[model samples]
Target chain A: MSGAFEIYRRWLRDRRRSTIVWSVSIAAVSVVTAAFFSSLGQSLGENAESGSTTSSMLGLSDGIDPQTPTGFLWAANYSNQLPWLMMALAIALGTAAIAGDEADGTLEYVLSKPVTRSAIAMARAAGMVTILFISAIVNLVAVAITAPLFDLYDSVTITGADGSTSTASGLTFGQLVVGGLAAFAVALGSGAIAYLLGAASGRKGWAMGGASGFAVAGYVLYTLSNVTGDLEFLTWISPWRWFIDDAMMVNGLTWDILWPFALTVVAVVAGWQLFLRRDLQN
Target chain B: MTVIEAQGLTKKWGDFAAVDDLDLAVGEGECYAFLGRNGAGKSTTARMFLDFLRPTSGSVKVLGGSGADPEVRSRIGYLPGDLNLPPTMTGIEAVHYFGSIGHEPDTAKVQALMDRLGLTADRPFHQLSTGSRRKVGLVLAFMNDPDLLILDEPTSGLDPVLQDTFRDMVIEHKQRGATVWLTSHVMSDVDRVADRVGLIDQGKLAQQLSMDELRTKSTGNITLTFPDAPDVSSFDGVEGVSNVQVADRQLSIHVDGPVTAVLARAAELGAVDIQTEKNDLEDIFLDTYSHEAGR
Candidate 1:
């Protein structure tokens, strides 16, 4: 194998146990989430079709119609939750890419190899992104499998209150796939940040601490930006804002989507440079 | 041609100078031993040679290139004093990984070294005992058969049998014209294998001596047991005798020169069970360091 692929393979082998745990957990969570949301969406659709009030069907008011499309119900109730879940998974898994090696005293051995320090950082970040992408695919599969079990099949169609029709036909799977890829890219950026911190500190605990602190700080900034008129610029700097704002799961992918990917590339390059220049004490 | 050269080599950590204004050169096919107490900067010097640590205000050239150049590194094999391998990797796997870095998958060299050192390939690094781990380090250091070999305490955990085997391996490498630089606390190892030895004390080169010269210059000890405690005072002013001790029936004298004078004195004392032993490297090493420290 070439150096890059060799590094990639080593990372995969190192994280094989974590990957198994994450895959199983994501699969379980996906199945439960998909089932719950599919059932809720089907119930709302039935109420809308029966000429009942949508509010009562959603348990928000009395007498709701049951003719609503299951796709509309699912989108209304679950679409926003995807970003939060994806962000949490990305931060947890991606942040460990560099930090874990430093903590375990393996960074020195890795650096002693012929591979450049920057390549070590980039290859590990890429591995984390790949793992996150695979997790997203597995989650999407679980959603697909469970959605049709609750009468939320491809044929269901419902009109929104705005008179816009939504259906499983309008759900572009390709767009969702691209959205997942975009989320993976954002994860790579987070991983790069963590890798740089790990390389600078030469301590796994410090790296993880810094990454966790950054993630929390990013979320707080995004939330504050949304709530306050001032400090609005925080949203642009927050990775979470970029992630949630750019998710186009059911909508078609856009060229504007390139912004997050570009940001990821920048973060990765910066991290690699920092890692290359730092002295690895271990 | 010199395979490694260091000029005015110095390394400092804040106020502490780990290596100070040191200069050394190793020619092709030469085996040089660095002798010193712990923390005497042997490892620091080696690290500087490998460019693992940048010198404060000096330079090191390896194989006719700057220490930091990959080309120089490609031609040298290094065993760090704190050589730690990844715990998760097997011996073979770890060797293979390092080989990959060197841009070749020479499993045969690794296997040959392991066989010579009796290192098992299936053993995980953490599972190996300390001696076995040291063997693994040795195998890694010599597996590449580079033009220059830099090792620190290379035989630390080796058993006597394996130590002999390793010595033979070093000799084989030397025969092929590979320069070997090693450090060890075992004076016998250095005395047996090193053509020349550099003694360092407190980060300073105290003395450099060839094996034959060191042996000839070192003090010898003579122990004599008498049937009755005869007057040992007569031997006190004898030539080449530095110190004399008289116990109830035994006399011990530290002598520097030909034992014939001390032997004649012993015969005059009507001494029985006379025994004479030359000062080995241990005595010379202790005296050398103590003297250097005092200076």
Candidate 2:
């Protein structure tokens, strides 16, 4: 096997237990939440009509009807909970990609071999992304399996902006794909930032703290912008804005999903360059 | 032929030089032991040989090529002083993992080493004893049968039997024309295996001498205890006696050559007891390093 793949495989094998735990935890939570939507059907519809705090917090803005299965699942689970968990997992993996091994003194020994430093960095980052993707896929599969058992596949009624009402079936499988894609993008972008920090500093604390701080700052900026007209421009830089503005699960695929992927690619390139120039910490 | 060469090698951290203008060479089939106190730049110099750290100044050549080249690295085996492996991997797994980086490992040889070193292959590295961990490191280093072996404190945590086994392995590798460069603060570990010794102090090469040369320069010592304080200055200005000290009824004499002159002088002084002590590598090592402060 090539050295890069060898290292990548080792990382995957080593992290197998942690990856299984994270994936199962997220998937189980999603399935349980979906199962609850059946019993909460009437109450959630009443809250959506009255515009309760819980409704707003779930991002049930205009055009989204919580009475429908798609809106209920997206609002109650995907919007806030799933993305946060994925972001946490991604960031943790990214921090461990380089800085964690460096701290533990494993990276130095690995680099002593005939393999190039870039190979090690890139392989480790790829391993982190693979786990993130697996977590998202696992959650997607669980929700899909449980959504129908809760009667979430039925037809739905919708009202247009012209005050006209219409009836339509639930969202298609394509919508589920776009929704999962959006979540994956958000998680990857944040993780890439952590990866960049780790590559630049070779310090796990710096990577973990810096990336988490950036994520929090972006969320706060996006939240405050929604409350005031003057701060609306700040939402442009927030990942939350891109994810929430288009309501990817309800709406079809949009250009906003591409933003995170672009940011991730850039982070990977910049991180590789930074890592190539610095000295390995002993 | 010289398998390893460094000229004007220097590594500095800010204003402090870890290694300063060092020059060294190890010929093929030669076991050159690098002797130094802690922080004397032994590891830093070794790091440069494997391109783990770039020199602030000067250059290093290994196996007649730049150490940074993968082709050059493929022919060298290195064991860092502080060995750390992935905590979850077993010894056998580590062997295969590191082997893939260089060449296909000879499993038979690996098993032989495991048996010889008394290492259990199934146990995870973190679960192994310190000696077992060192065994894993040794197996990994010698698995590829590289042309050059750069080991830093190769036998640090090993038991006496294992240390002797390690010395025998180095001797066998040397007979096959492999160049070995090892660093150690302990004299006994290297004194048996090394062909030449280089003493480093304060990141500088203080002395480099072959075993034969050192034997000639540092002769044995003889102490004569007389019945009384008879002619305390009897051995003073003796031709072969380089150092002498008189205390009570005992006279300690350090000789630079054959003990004939000192033995003759001791008989004339009516010595009641005579004890001869050979000059050991530890004494020479201490003399070179005691001047430097604790690093």
Candidate 3:
């Protein structure tokens, strides 16, 4: 167990520079996006009322107002930029867990030590997850520091289904935390897929390409299903459905967020089994 | 006691056999040199001993245990043919990182090795030259003072000085009762240290012999300066004389063993000047391969 931890710590140290760069870059983008909320808040209702096709397609439908801090944060950051940034980080880190090191021939040396393949696998996965969590936490802390200044805490006016108007309270601290966890879960799922591909194939490019393709396909499938009722069943396969359709940040929480987390577990097991059984190719 | 043992070891990749059924053994404190050309399964065999590659069939035992066992691997020091280190890590960091994998390495020993190899401890791996990278590998492999050393082409990128240092280090370890198995294209390194040499060609063990046996296998040539161009066939049937040729006033006879019969024939030819040149290991190596290929 200590040997595995040692491997974990060494891998984290190896990825130190990359972790810092990705974390800071993602945090900076989140902070800058939060800065635009005040001005955008003023025209939020008009933009939705204008019946902009773009807003509807982006899940910014009438029910999701860009005026509130939660809605704006979700639309501007979490919905697109935040999840995409996290996915990019996850894929890069996940592919590197095995495929990258195998290609570089470093994994063989590491494995030559008095450590089991299972220990090394668990250690690498742990390191990758830690980095992903750090990036998510950076984005969350950046948003927390910048949210109040944009009047993101003020009560939000949410019109009901029967033309009744009501003000929903300001974005609560709990909601923001839950929202961050949801985003992290989504990234974790995507990264796990990449990790699985890398461990199974021992090819970095395959992992990167396969995971990225899965993300794009999930998005296209989910959005097209919304645009066409015929493909609605495909939404279950898209992680986007659990993230956006449930309106995790705005409407409080639901079981949808757990899907990605569950997928992450399954992927890890599958990857571990594949890695242990196969040869470490050069 | 045998420290290394393999029985019917075979490794195949689809239709291609990287290593065929082979049985080998290396006794404690013996220096066994594995010699083969490129793509000759030397590195593949080494990898199997470390469990980096699983065997298709058969078994290899190291230190009386399976190579796949961590306890067994902990006692072995391995240097791969292709040494790769993370570009971001300095030599100092690598020493610490790889050293922590098993029992702690002696700091003084590591520093001494670095000094002897002329490696820059603070330089990142990518900044180091090819020879310097090999130096780092040597330091890492020798750090733990392991019981068995499996080095593949250990002196490939080394300078002549470093190569000599490596040879001395191996000899010192052997003196201390460590078993050494290594592969190298530099026959001199083998000629100077190997107790036994195994020649592998096209995934099969072609020949296995001791250093003295290898020396004896070399063909010695006798050059005789005659008064005039003599008939080469005049000495053809002489014992141990072959490929006899006469050029100008000189007669050349190739002898595989004792030169007594050739010397007698030369005396009968009334040769004024006679010279005998012995073949080295390099000649024997080439001869073995060519002879195998011819079959």
The candidate maximizing lDDT is: 3
Candidate 3 CAPRI classification by DockQ: medium
Better of 1 and 3 by DockQ: 3
For residues B114-205, write the lDDT of model 3, one tens digit per residue. 99888888999989888888898888888888899999999998989889999999999999999999999998899888999999988899
Restricting to chain A, the TM-score for each candidate equals 0.72, 0.91, 0.92
Candidates 2 and 3, the one with greater DockQ: 3
For each candidate, give the TM-score of chain B: 0.86, 0.92, 0.92
The order by descending TM-score is: 3, 2, 1
Best by DockQ: 3
Off by over 4 Å in 1: A1-5, A40-103, A110-129, A136-147, A150-170, A228-230, A250-256, B103-109, B225-233, B236-239, B248-250, B257-273, B284-295
TM-score, chain A only, candidate 1, equals 0.72
Residue B175 in candidate 1, Cα distance off native in Å: 2.5
RMSD values for the candidates in order, in angstroms, are 5.8, 2.9, 2.6
Interface RMSD of 1: 2.8
Judge candidate 1 against the unseen true structure and give its global Cα lDDT, from 0 to 1: 0.68
